[model samples]
Target: MRACHALLAATLAVAVLLVPVGAATTAGAPAVQQTPTPQVDDGAPPDRPVEVLTLADDDANRSATRETTLDVGPAVGAATDAAGHELRTIRALARVRGADDPDAALSREFDRIGARAAGLGRQQRSALQAFADGEADARTTLLVLARVDRAARALENRRERVVTTARGEGATVPSERSVALARELGVYTGPVRSQVAAALSGAEPPARVYVSTTPRGVTLAALTESGYVRETYRGDLRRVDDASLTRSAARDAVAAAYPSLWRVRSAVDVDPARVSTVRMTYDGGELAATVGSRNRRVFRDAHRQSLGVAGTDRQAVNTRDGFRLVVNRSYAGGPMRIQLRTVDGDPVAADLTIGPEGGESSPVGTTGPDGERWLLTPDERFTLVAIRGNTVVFITMDPLAAPRTERP
Candidate 1:
């Protein structure tokens, strides 16, 4: 009995990836998770009519919510108006893709301009030496210096334009067609465009990218029903309007390719007056679901798993939203917290640790979800296990991570 309780407690302690079945079990005692919910004083006073509960529409959203935002559409360049700007990026990409790269066009351009300036500096000394040795022409030396200076300045200006237009550092947003361009950009509208423009004007492209970022069925249910919660998060995939796109073979290929790394969990509930929900949960902790007209699914990258899983029957699920899976035990290798890559591929992982890290920046209160100003260690953890039924990815996390989260 003690062993079973210990295992269940351990199951809750780990942040996620699936745990093996026959997990610690007591012969007769009920699992803590299976225990019935205790009644709360949430019932209204007698004589008051019982009201229906609905997800808040920007008002009473009291879920413990966390969010991450990023934009990872295509990279920002290909300036239309600037004739020469696009040429540079295309050329740079060409250089990146080059085979022999003998001339090294991009680097050569940078070097060529630098070399001219260096040659000019050396010219005066070389000219003096030649003059001393009575082996050079003064007029030729002077002309060489003049030509180098003129050429160097021209190269510098060209380089500056390349930096500015490609990265939007000094250049404007090319506002001439902002309105029309916006529609094409879609959800990656204002901020993404602005960020892209800003990025192009800088030195390097963004360091990362987001493959997906959407919440799912389970996450919504957990958040809306969880006690006194507040959070902001982004999921791995977006639940698009079209089912075809969601359940396409191409997507399945992507999932099976990287079964352990990428997956989906989906579920449907038909209780409480014909309510149906599909939650696609990933080890990445992205949650997304579909209720009615709205299609919800977390977006994430193509962690294509090339190898195939050898098994008699693997779970596969498809419904209104669409999803599939390849099974694998997530935490077999080691213990590491799961994090979803934002559109920019930044770490937008859910903070499951109840340590100082999660507390320091939490908006819940002055200290943290706990009364203590800080959590010295992780009181909880979760591990990724598997994505089931096309849309349900089962996970295990220590409910202790945010102990007293309700207080905040």
Candidate 2:
């Protein structure tokens, strides 16, 4: 009977061990798994497997042999359950952070635009005041005003684009009040910019002319379309403000330097120690000359003329110092030709030398009746000196082909 009772007790323990730890008991409570103590052959306890409720790492939690249940309290001052209240708070904070991030970015962007607008406003005001004060000539003032107009237009366009993009992206941009004020400011500035453009239209002249004050005298230069200094005069300024005198000087210099630029406008740069000079540059050649005051003598033979005939690769001519000479290089390694003619197209027979200065003079060549003759040399950079009855002209030849004109 005792053996039968012992066998029945063993069966009951086996049934309890077979029950799942996650299962509910008859009292509707979770069954906790109790860890059994480990045994060792040497009579010492071994390390048992520990079941931990991990605060991090979902994989460990998913693989846990025992289940864990937590009952947290409600959020502070809230009536809802703790989990639900905490979840709602988390969602609300996430939304607030999301909105704040873009809002902060928008604020920074608009602030920069606002600063640019303020600076542009100051520039516009100063420009207007300068126009009223006649601080510079009409052309200079108009040029400055035109630049301001362009800058303002650019800013206005960018502001419009920013507002449109922000609206499209559902972003919180500048406030309605700020936008309205900006629009009002735009309205005020529009007419001002337009007025400036109109004033420029009436007051603007040809390419800018500059008169700069120097330590030695005064300088007058015409700004070319490509921003080059078309220096017209550099000489003593008996009267720094003498427009007539400067105009005359410019006329004389133009006549001597670029006869074709007769209608050129003038800008003055005044200096005392600066040397005054004039230059006319062509594609393959350049001519330069030193000049003095308005009373300075002009070169009588300073006529503009072509150097090479039609269809030549390189041609250059200088009609200054009472002479005319044109050198034409037909092709590389081909015989370079010298063509001398007067402004009237009469052939000028002259002896020509081609080489570097102070170097051995190349074989002399004389022009034919047609003012064309070949010099035996490679197409390269070398000085050409032509002499005829006590008259000498020196010209440097560049092999590259570029067509340009400068005058006496």
Q: Estimate each model's TM-score.
A: 0.17, 0.23
The whole-model C-alpha lDDT of candidate 1 against the native structure comes to 0.25
TM-score of candidate 1 on Cα atoms, chains taken together: 0.17
lDDT of 2 by residue, 57-135 (tens): 1111100000011112211212232344345334433443456465554455456556666675565445434433445
Q: 1-408, model 1: which lDDT tens digit per residue? A: 011111112222222222234345478422333212221121111111111111112221111222222222211222232345345445644443452442244345445434544554355335433432335443333223223333333445555444343333222333322211221112111122222233333433431111111112011110111111111112222333322222333333333322332334332122110111222233223221222112322221111111121111111111111211111111111112222222343322222222221233222212112211111112123223222212122233332211110101
lDDT of 1 at 310: 12
Q: All models: lDDT?
A: 0.25, 0.36
Per-residue lDDT, model 2, residue 398, is 38
Best by TM-score: 2
